[model samples]
Target chain A: MNAADVLDGGVLDAARALRERRVSVADLVAESLGRINAISGLNAYVDVFGDQALSLAQAHQTMLDCGYDLGPLHGIPVSLKDNVDMAGVVTTAGSAILKDNVPVADASVVSALKRAGAIVVGKNNMHEFAWGGTTANPHYGTAGNAWDASRSPAGSSGGSASAVAARTVFASIGTDTGGSVRNPAALNGVSGIRPTIGRVSNGGVFPLAWTLDTVGPIAKSSQDCAVVLQAVAGHDPRDLQTSAEPVPDYLAELERPLAGIRIGWIHDYSVKDVQPAVRTAFEAATATFESLGAIVTAVAIPDLDAIVDALVVLDAAEPSALHGRWLRERGDEYGPDVRAQLEAGFVLSAVDYVQAQRYRTHIRARFAEAFRAVDAILTPTLPFTAPRIGQDVIDIGGRDRDVHTANMQFTALASVPGLPALNVPMGFDAGGLPTGLQIITPAFEEGRALRLGHRFQMATTFHLKAPPR
Target chain B: MDETDSIRCRLRAHGIRETEAAVGLAASWLRNAARVRAVVEEVVGPAAGPVTAFTHVPAGLHGEERRERR
Candidate 1:
């Protein structure tokens, strides 16, 4: 099969075709690189591995010819967020400070993807140091939204989501700390799964908030995400944070029936500061869940306001500590928002940081208590749709607020507690932007979230609906 | 000293050159910290035992630290 045919079929489809010898591996990589170059205006990629990708594909094809099965992701084109290491490539983390900081070894996640015979198409652009909600990086040109060229792709994982939405790559890995990965996916109308903390290794991935950080998949659909997860989710010796817990067969669980599954709808958390469009879409999503034979019930997690406040402190403080010396010496080199936030961290007392951590312990325990009663919790992935590029302030729910604060409110529900949260495309709002329904499962239970998401997609055609080309 | 002055003093002590916006953000976080503590007190109760920070790094990885502490 030709490049165009394989490129249009997506990651899982192309992988199947490659295994059957219906499509050439080299042809798929070439098509992915061509698409990357064609959509260069989106600023999705900071670096394109055209030569390396082709070489890898050729090698994988030879292995396939020798009757060697490399695994599910064999011959698939995948992008890594720039923060992730690719050995020889400079892992910029979208910051000038780390502009020339190349790693001597591939990140553990990168090794896993390579082992699965996946070609690293390029390093996707992100908010500098994965600090901001919008991909409006001052150092690198902003990553444009796939749906509308002029709008923002809510990020730190903006480019990854944009690339997936535009169908440039089958999937991309992005780190989530306070809604980075899932935010971009939600805004761009794609599947993004932030697995529970320690479920996936973070060995070579750049840290934002070490305690809250997680590497996750941003793909065309939840099933595609599961395939990627199957390849990458496991205990890695390199990352101490990776739990010894066994990685479940995520793809196998996707086909399970949703009948009798209890989905918790935290009414207080779900409705707070939610935009009218989002509220409408989320209500419809819950109704659809009920129709699918899943029992959806309203539940509560206490001290939510305190939890949000604690998250802000922890998120800001950790990055501050990570970038403290740089902020002191090269303060002017950082982006305005990042620099300001870093400086704000220095202004915080260690007492405040400690208090936030203490609060985090309290919040996690509360979530643990709530999860015992339900299999999954449901909420809107974002409070509102993607905002216009360079738009910092927005009127959400009739109250003006910082765009990042507003975008993070719903996604943070999962992030703060470090749970497995999956964003599935629910439907489009009145403004034509996609709305995402978030399904959050208990820690280390990614299969539960993916299964529910897969069932939702099977019942509805939302994930299949492409962005307006 | 006033709140702004106190914030400026704190920033200076931290070796961060104070700007109006940075000071403002700092003061805001300080306010948030107070509110957070209040909520924690309300929910978990005062005289609450100190909770260690959330960390996923396994204890085995901190063997060196444990040894050093001993």
Candidate 2:
């Protein structure tokens, strides 16, 4: 097969071909590098480790010759969002403050990937310190949408989604705090999974909001996401938040049928004020689930708006406390928007932060109660498709809403409760931009989300659709 | 002190030097405080103390495999 065909087939297909000697690891790495260099204008990658990637690929080939197979991800070239450490490389969490801060050890997730034989291709770009949803970064140029270069790939993990969608890399690891990973995946038309918080360690990832942050995979398909999750999902001693629970075989769960599964849709909160196209696509997704023999039900949760308000409090205050010293010493180094947000965090009283957490416990109980009657919950990942680059306000259901709030509303439902959520490409809107279907499962039940996402992909061609190059 | 001035003092106390932008941010907070207060009164119990920790994943729940709880 040709290089384009092999790369477009995604991580799982490429790995199968490698094991069968249909393609060389070095040749695959070369193809990924060539694509990365070709799309430099996307600003998806802040740094490309071409030599290191090739060296790693060569080493994988040597291991294969010795009959030592590491795993499914062996020899696959993957990119890391800049917040993740890579030993000697500068782990700039998309900020000038950490410009010279290089780590001496790899992040636990990165180490797991290395052990699984995945080659590190580069570090992807992100929002400055992951403080914003739009990756229209001041330090690194924005990561443009794969469907339309004039539009944004919503961030802070915009680069990883863009790189995966553009076929520059088979998959990329990204951090999600308040929908950073899934928003970009929705806009760029790829698969992203924000695993249950603490399913993967946050030891070496730069902190945005430690309580809200999670590292996950953005890739070509839900199956690819499961493979990546299988490699990285486990407990680590460094992160106290990580539970000592057993990690399941996520890849093995992907083939489970959709029959007899119960899925819930909460229309009041999930569909309110959404774009018409997104609403239409979401309705079709429910119909698709029903046709696949899954039982779909409508459920309601109390005090959703209150939960969101409390989330705003928690999201704001945590980052403020974390960046307190840096904001005081080098406040001028941060972008004006980020600086404004940090300042807003300063104004929140201790009472406000405590009340928000108490509200979080309340909301957590509500979701837990809802989950007892269903296997998963379904919603639109974002209210709309990719907005025009630099467009701050968007029209949603005849009302003007800030792009950040509109992009974050649906995704934050899962984020607030620390549930595992998956963003699957549903289909394209009128303007040819993709709409996303979000599947959220109970905490640590990432396999349920992936199983449903895999079944959806099998019944549709959305995951296989390529952007106009 | 007025609402804006009160926030300006807090900003300075937090080592923020600039007042104009921070004050503008403070105005929004003051506006939103009414809504935040309503939620706090309704959902947050009076006896509830400051939440210092979060239970991310329940201990007994394993991923997909239902392993015996530790």
Candidate 3:
């Protein structure tokens, strides 16, 4: 297999190859560093730890010589979103305020990945503080979309998605609150999961929303995500929010057959809001699921628009609480847009905050009732292909639409419900850019979503589509 | 909506201090939302059940520690 194929291959496949000693760790890290250097214009990383990643790979090689080995990710290089803390590295959430902020220890997920024998290659850029969906960072630099440099890699986890899609690394970890991970993954034609809340401990990652924030992986396929999930999802005493449940064999779940799986078609949920390109790809995805022997039905649980407001209010409130003092003292350090949103969060009344929580409880119950009749839900991942840079709005049809609004058209619902959602690349647009079809499962049913995604990925060629350098 | 006044009220009431511009935008959203809510009430009528909330925990289940019993 070519270096791209090996790097982009399933983590299990790579592990088997590593176990057999067919591919050396030194060589793999070299190829990844080459890919990052080749695409220097994407600016996917805030700092590329070339020496550190190489040193780790060498250490893994020595481990093999000594007849000792780490688990599945032995010798694989992984990039981390900047918001995640790593000892000796600055955790600049793509802003000047924290640009000089260096961490003395690793984030919980970073420690987990290291224990699995993965190499931390570098820190990825983001839309400052993981607040906005687009990955455009005026401070560090926007991580350009893999297919088109003119368009964005979706953020605030854009850097992680682009680095993986462009073959800069084997896999990367990113945060998802209101679709930070999945948005860029879809935009870049890769795979990412927003695992159920509290499944992965958030201990070391900077807080976006103490209640809603989650850190997840962006990888080449659902299988890759499953491996990363195994490494990262666990309870931590530092993060009391983590569930005390045991981690399952996510890789085994991927091989589960799609037969008899009931996937609900949320076609009309926001059909009017989605772009025609996304709408078409979603229909194709539903057909693919049916052809695989999965029964499908139309269902509507609750208005997503109603749930979105509750999620937004709650998300903004938490982040604003953490950053309010920073913003007040160093207002100029923040980007104008982030400042505006943070400011708005402060004005929300205590009653309004309480009411949003109530609304969330009500919606969760409503969705639980719907899930009783269906195993999964399928929807468009993003409403359209990437819009050009410098244009914060798109003229969809005759009316002007905000780019942020259009980007989250499909993603916001899952975020609000705190359910598991996967963004799997479905197909390319006419311009060769990719569009993703989202597969969503009810809270804690990530295995089912991965199974469905893995099945479709095996049956289709979209997951293999690569952007030319 | 002076920053100092807004900050004082939010801090005292909710332990938060906010900028004036943020409050203005929030107020705009609140105003529009209240209008929409009132209209919905006119059509669907007032809620028949109490607005159940989980604000104050029961004495036995009070804090994150949740007073575990042997």
Candidate 4:
């Protein structure tokens, strides 16, 4: 297959091709690296080490020739968000403060992916400290939506999401603090999952909020995410917060039918002013889910707004707390916007901090109750189409709404509740920007959400659609 | 009405000095509670003092220190 055809194949197909000796790891790695260079205009990567990737791919090929199976991702080239530590590499988190910060070891996730035989092609850019919703970084230039260069790729995982969407990398990992992973995934037209906080270790990844920080995959398909997740998910004693709960075979669960699953749709979370096209596309997705033997229910999640608010507050507070000193002494070192938000975090009170934690505990129960009645919750990943770069707002239902808040509306909720939400491309909006239908399930129930999302994608043409390369 | 400002003052009044250049220590700790707390009140409605997780840093820094010790 040609580069375009190879790039379009999902991770499993590509891996199966490599496993069966139909494709060379060197070829795939070279193609991905070439695309990354060609799409340098997208600013999707923080750094790309083409030589290193080729070396790793060759090493894996050598092992396979010796009848050695490294793992599921033997020859796959995977990009990581810059915030993740990769031993010899600097982890900037797209910030100037840690621009020179290098690690002596790889993050658990990076280590796991490497152990599973995935090639680390490069590090993707992100909003400073994973703070903002829009990936317009003052430090690293904003990563444009692959399909529409003029539009914003949602942040702080924007670069990772954009890279995958742009076919610059087979798949990339992004941290979802508020809506970092899903918003970018939605806007850039890809699949990403913010697995339950403790379900995935946060050992070496930069922290946005210890309470809400979870590392997840931004991939071309839920199946791809499962492949990536298998390598990354598991308890690391290093992360005391990681659950001892058994990690299921996520890929095996992906093939299960979605029949009789109860899915809840939140029209309110859909936002009051979603573009008519987005709403119609989202509804069509819901109808598709309904047709697949899944019962769609509209359920009100109590304290939904408060939960999102609490999550934002908590997310802001923790990062600010973790990075507060660096910000104070070297405030100029940060990107202007990240510094501003971190400064805002410093202004919150101790009571407010406690309240956010208490709110997290209080709000999680409400979602738990809702999940008892439904297998998953569904909403649009983003309420509107992607906005133009430098366009900080959009006209929503006649009102020009702030992009950050609007982009985060549906996504922040899942963070607060600590649930697993999958962002699957639904269709383009009026602007031809990709829109995603977010599927959320009870904490650690990524299986249910993935099964439902996989089925939905199987019945729809959206996942098969691609950005103009 | 200025919740952000109230948080600011609270962080200041309580003397939450940052350990590094990146964070403000105290105020940064409270953001999520404020946002989620507001919604909790909206959804659950009218929480008494018991439902609130806040323990006022007593009039003195001593009280705040003691509270932290807990």
Candidate 5:
């Protein structure tokens, strides 16, 4: 097969071809680099490690030639969000202030990817310090959506989703503090997973909220995400917060049918004030799941608003504490939005922070109660489709809502309780932009979410839809 | 002092200088935080614990043994 055909195929397909000697790793890397360069206007990449990627590709090819196959991800090309550390490379975290912050060692996730024989193509751009959802970085230019360059990718992992959607690489890793990974994945028509917090190590990655932050995978398909997750989801001694629970066979779980699985539909909170198109897509997804023999039940999360407010408190306060010294010393260097957010964090009282933590326990207990009757919960990833690139206010249900707050409403439901959530492409809006469905499962039950998502993708063609070139 | 003044003082205490407009925004955020805290306090019991608590048990034993004790 030619380079384009191989690049267009899924990661597992590429893995099969590699073992059969149908494609060379060097050609795949070259095609990925060429594609990234060809669509420079997308601004999906912050730094393309062309030389190093090619060298590693050649090395992997030699390993395969010597009958030493690494694994499913062997010889696959993937990108990392700029916030993740790659030794000898600057981990900018999409901020001008951290331009000189280079680590001598790779982050634990990066090391795991390397060990699986995945070649690191480059670093994708992100929102500054991941403080906001839009990937409009002041220092690294705004990353555009693959479907429409003029629209937002619903960041902070915008660039990673864009690359995956544009087929620049097989997959990319992104950090999600508050729906960063899943948000962009929805907007860009891809699949992304935020494993339960502590499922993946946070070592060498920059902090947003110490407790809320998680590293996750964004890819073209749920199966591809499973392949990537299998390589990276495990405990690391370097990150003390990582779970000691053994990582399950995620790929093995993907082919299971959704028969008899109970999915909870948040009747009130998830559907409130959502755009009509998003609501329609979510309803269709619900119907599709029912058609697959899965039982759907209406579940209410009455205190969802309070839980989101608590999320706001913790998300704001933790990042501010992390950047407290810098905000005082070099406050002028940060972008206007992030700087303003950091300043707002200072005004939150100690009582506010402590109450938010207490509220987290309450919300988790509520979800645990809900989970006793349901195996998983389904909701829309975002309340609206991707807005225009730089637009702050969006109309939802005839009222203007702030884009930053609206984007986090449904996403925070899972983030606050540290549950595993998956974003899968459901369908397109009238504007042809993609809308996503979120599947959330209990802690350490990422397999459930992936299984539901995989079954949905198998029965639908939404995930196979590529952006207009 | 009024809430805005209190917020401005807190900002100054942290040595973070900002314009009056920015300080006003911060004050608004603080008001919202106050409302959130009240809502949380209404639902959370006196015996309820925060999620960020430190444990005396080691990391390895915190999972199984802690659950057993509970």
Candidate 6:
């Protein structure tokens, strides 16, 4: 089978083909490498593990021949964000300073993916140190949107989402500190999930913000994300923050019916500042839920705006602490945007960080209160669709707003409370850019979010739609 | 000195030297952080403790065992 034909069906479909011996693991790896090279202009990858991937694929193929199966993701080709470590590979975190940094052992998540028989083809490009939303890497080239080359694939998981949208891989692991995974997934017109904090281990993954950092999967559909999540979600002794809660059967949960599910639409705060097209798409998604027998209602989150603001302090301070030594000794090697943010972090007083943490507790209680009336809350993933590459400011409702702040508005709502949020493509605007509907569930209730997203994908073809090649 | 200079001095105190333009950017970020801090302090009372988690100690490392060892 041709590469396009093999990858077009996504992880589960490809898994079926693999089990039936229609395509060998080597074939999938070769096709993924070819596609990565073909779309080299997108800058979707920082380093391609061509030979190493093929060798691993052959070993997996050998296992299959010997009547051994490693489960659903067996032999599936996927990529990892640059910040995720793969043994012997340079984990640059999309920065120049760490270009030569190599790990002796795989990240716990990488080991999990390997144990599940998933092939790691390459490392996706990201915003340097994940301090920014745009994947306009100053060290590695900027990653372009799969839908429109001149537009951004909202980042720091830009390349991961772009590669998935472009069908270079079945799925890619992207980390979220403040909506890094879901934001890019939304802009790239794919399905991505930020598993509740601690649902997946963060061992060996470079830190952005310790409290909010999470590893998640971006794929063509929620079911595919579930498969990836199933492989990676579990306790790791290396990561003390990882949850001891049992990892639920996410794939099994996807089969659950959407009937009678209480879906809350955060109408006031979520819809107040969105672009017209995004708002329209959000309404349509809400209506689709209602049609699916979900009881959709307006839910108010009074502290939403304040929580978003407080997140900035934590995002700035925590990462600054991690990068303090580097910023002080070798600051010039850092990208301008990341360096400035790190400098800003140094200026924040300890009281500011403490206040932000207190605010996190305050806002989490508010979310818990709202969750009492609803199973999940819905909002537009971003206030606007993917902006033009290199554009820092965007016009929303006739007022120009900073792109970074606008991108995080809806995403931070989930991040502040470490809630599980899924970004599912709803529809496209007139310009053909996709709009995403975000489903935020209570902490450790990622299955609810996945079930809602999977049902939405089953009812609509938005997640299945590919960008024009 | 102005706010930008004040921030530049702070950055220097942290051993980071940047150009004038970068310092200005850092100043804006500092102002933004300050604004967020103010909003958070307004809503969060002193009675509310910071959201912090202590690292998990092993089963036998604490309490009676540690007391017995001492």
lDDT of 4 by residue, A6-42 (tens): 7678877786788777778888899999899988888
DockQ list for all candidates: 0.22, 0.35, 0.12, 0.14, 0.32, 0.20
Q: What is candidate 6's lDDT per residue for A290-376, written digit by digit as tens?
A: 999999998887656566677788898898899888887888899888888887777777877887887877777677677766788
lDDT ranking from best to worst?
Answer: 5, 6, 2, 1, 3, 4
Stretches > 4 Å off in candidate 2:
B30-34, B46-70
Ten contiguous residues minimizing lDDT sum, candidate 5 chain A: A301-310
Error of 5 at A91 (Å): 0.8
The A-chain TM-scores of all the candidates are 0.97, 0.99, 0.97, 0.97, 0.99, 0.99
Cα displacement (Å) at residue A360, model 6: 0.6
Off by over 4 Å in 5: B52-70
Which is better, 5 or 6, measured by lDDT?
A: 5
Worst 10 residues of 6 chain A by lDDT: A301-310
Tens-digit lDDT string for candidate 2 (B1-70): 8887788888788887753666776667544544666766887677654432335433323323233110
Q: Which digits, one per residue and each the tens of the lDDT, describe model 1 over residues A148-235?
A: 8799998999999999898889999999998888889998999999998888999999999998999999998899999998888988
Q: How far is A346's C-alpha from truth in model 5 (Å)? A: 0.4
TM-score to true structure, per model: 0.94, 0.96, 0.89, 0.89, 0.96, 0.95
Report lDDT (Cα) of residue A59, candidate 5.
Answer: 94
Docking class of 6: incorrect
Off by over 4 Å in 6: A1-3, B52-70
Question: What would the TM-score be for candidate 3 when compared with the true structure?
Answer: 0.89
- For model 5, residues A328-399, the per-residue Cα lDDT tens digits are 889889998889889888888788888888888778878777776678889999999999999999999899
